[model samples]
Target chain A: MSTPFLKKDKTGICLKLHTALYGHDAIEQFRGAYGDGLTFVRRGAYWILSFADALEEDVVDSLDSLLVLSRNRKK
Target chain B: MKKFIKADGWVKVPVQTKAYPLQAIYSAGYVFMDKAYLYLDLEAKDKVVVWLKPKAKADLDKLAMEFCQELLNYAHYFSSLKVNAESTKLLLQRALFSAAPSMVKEAEEKEIQDLIKELEQEEEKENRKPVKKGKK
Candidate 1:
């Protein structure tokens, strides 16, 4: 809600999060929750989430926030 | 304040492993897990690197200082725990064993009664069996 994720202000197309930071469990949690419409690719230490369709900036931010929430819940 | 490496949207805080143990670092990292995105890596055999990326715009210097302080706090805690571990374990064992004797006695009594009943039933069955007539 504070601001958009750093992706040139167009963060809906694709998303990248360092796996070491948020962890693989977080991505799996995201996949179980919001991954039906997204493509997931694990490239080394990063998880790249490609959207299936064009989404609003706020929606993208919400998904990112969800990813963070999943990370917290993973503990 | 130690020199916090300035970077784009993130700061690198490095600590010497010789100064603080890995457990201390991990404990500090856990405290900051919800507050920031932490990526811990070993730069060398003796250097621990922590990359702290805040969710919002904040002072990187302050974050780094806080992390260091947390690490120190945990290190002290662990040391104190180690110092008192023997007495703590002894006290906990005494607390648990204080109630265990009665519980164990009751369980053993029940088991012995069940065994005695089974033996009595088997003996009764044997007594009730008709003795086969043997050649005189």
Candidate 2:
């Protein structure tokens, strides 16, 4: 019922992002985890993952971790 | 595609005949109401006044149906409901969230948890009933 990804404005801007995991490989990995119902979009700084089913909690956690890892790679 | 200018000064983007992105169009509406804070504004402003046209209601409805159908296809695969309750839940969530996250609305994680509970209940009901055995 709920969306696979939730959009938020970390910065107060007129934008509602459907951000998922980051990086090309990370996004692909996430799609593989939840079956073939997802479509990953690469937009600027984030990856948008669309799933027909509400993604499982574990999937979200894994994605969050992946993003953290991606962010850390820059440093 | 003719770039028509609206009376209220918004340059209306042409709806492309060749495979328009459904998400982008619908996302615009979400960004307007949720991110732009238009709906939350205290001013008694109306979209009708701006000439965006009330006719877009039909287009919006059609887009919603398309989105739901796509959602239903995916939902049927994992859903436990005999009548496809998971698809119905997806429709409900879209209406509530408008495809955007807001602090005022309940988190999507919580919504997913609630839906899982409903699915479990449905599964329980199915298990309670007995299957008839055939005579040899």
Q: What is the C-alpha RMSD of each candidate to the true structure, in Å?
A: 9.6, 22.9
Full-model lDDT for every candidate: 0.69, 0.38
Measured against the true structure, the TM-scores of the candidates, in listed sequence, are: 0.51, 0.22
Clashing pairs in 1: none
Where does the lowest 10-residue lDDT sum fall in candidate 2 chain B? B35-44
Task: Note the residue pairs that clash in candidate 2.
Answer: none
- In candidate 1, position B81 carries an lDDT of 92
lDDT of 2 by residue, B1-136 (tens): 2234332212223332123232332333332332111111111212111112221233433333443344344344434453678788988877867756682256867788899999999999999989989899
Error of 2 at A50 (Å): 1.2
In the order shown, the candidates' DockQ scores are 0.17, 0.01
Model 1 TM-score, all chains together: 0.51
Backbone Cα, N, C clashes tallied per candidate:
0, 0
Put down candidate 1 lDDT per residue, B71-119, tens digits, no spaces.
9998999889999999999888677767687856776799999999999
